[model samples]
Target: MRADAARNVDAVLRTGARLLAEDPAAGMGAIAAEAGVDRRTVYRRFPSREALLAAVFQAKLDSAQRVLDEARLVEAPVAVALHRYVEGIVPVSRDWPVDVRRMMRADPAASVRREEQSGRLDRFVQRAADEGLLRADVPVAWARATLDHLVDTAAHGFPLIDPPQAADLVVDILLNGVGRR
Candidate 1:
């Protein structure tokens, strides 16, 4: 694609995301109108509505990367790290489908980021285990998997109040195993 074509595509994708955040059912025509691009260009760039939406979502997730960075999931204690994880993920949780799917998809760039996230979470879990703060037998990989599920829920699961009521409880359940000592 030419430089102008790439710029036009990015513009359309940006417009589509802005519209979709307000209304997921926003139409292709509306997006094209917003971007001042023709319908042919929209279809030519994205091929399908889902593909376009996916691109919009990836952009949103990219914008959200700093939350994970601030959480310091790999730098802090397991329990505190888990709490920060909830705080980090809740904002982006509003648009769960796009965020969760794009993160989990096997795209090389996304995967590298995901692995970095996993490694950070792992380091925290390792520290917690060493401190006897978590179940010593809990595998770092399992902790990472549980976090992924929790974050995905924060994203894609049923909605509730703003900031989400169940996040702390769910994180607690994951860390504590929900059984009597």
Candidate 2:
């Protein structure tokens, strides 16, 4: 596609994502109006609401995967990688809060991507355990789940705090817990 066409597509997808997050019932017309594109343009790019939603969802996933890849989770020190991952994902979760549950159920490709990301995270948790960052007695799966919970919490709550502060808080809670030592 041409530069302007690509820009329009990006605008539409971004507008669609924001609108859907605010109201799942938001339609293409609203998204187009918000994006300053014609409704026909959106229709041309995505035949149905589901198609647009899927594209928006896919774009978020792709961005998240890129963040994880950039963090070098498998190669970096576990502590560093954990912080980096949380920091990287904050914007993705905050900006694209699409109804991921519904998308995962409705889109097969999304389901596969979710599993792929989960597998990577599980491996990263295992590595942390092997590095003695996580207690040996704790199951890797459990640790992974905890890490996911922490990241999600940070992502959801980031608007209340600075991104770096939120990332630090998440890492601190994950590594040190809430109890006074």
Q: Of the candidates shown, which would achieve the greatest lDDT relative to the real structure?
A: 2
Candidate 2: tens digits of C-alpha lDDT, residues 42-88:
99999999999999989999988988898799888888888888888
- Cα shift from native, residue 7, model 1 (Å): 16
Once fitted onto the true fold, the runs of candidate 1 whose alpha carbons sit more than 4 angstroms away are 1-54, 74-76, 99-106
TM-score of 1: 0.61
| Residue 181, candidate 2: alpha-carbon lDDT | 86
- lDDT score, candidate 1, position 148: 69
Per-residue lDDT tens digits for candidate 1, residues 32-86, read 9999999998998788877787677566556457666776766766666667667
Per-model lDDT: 0.68, 0.86
Cα lDDT of model 2 overall? Answer: 0.86
Off by over 4 Å in 2: none
lDDT of 2 at 148: 75
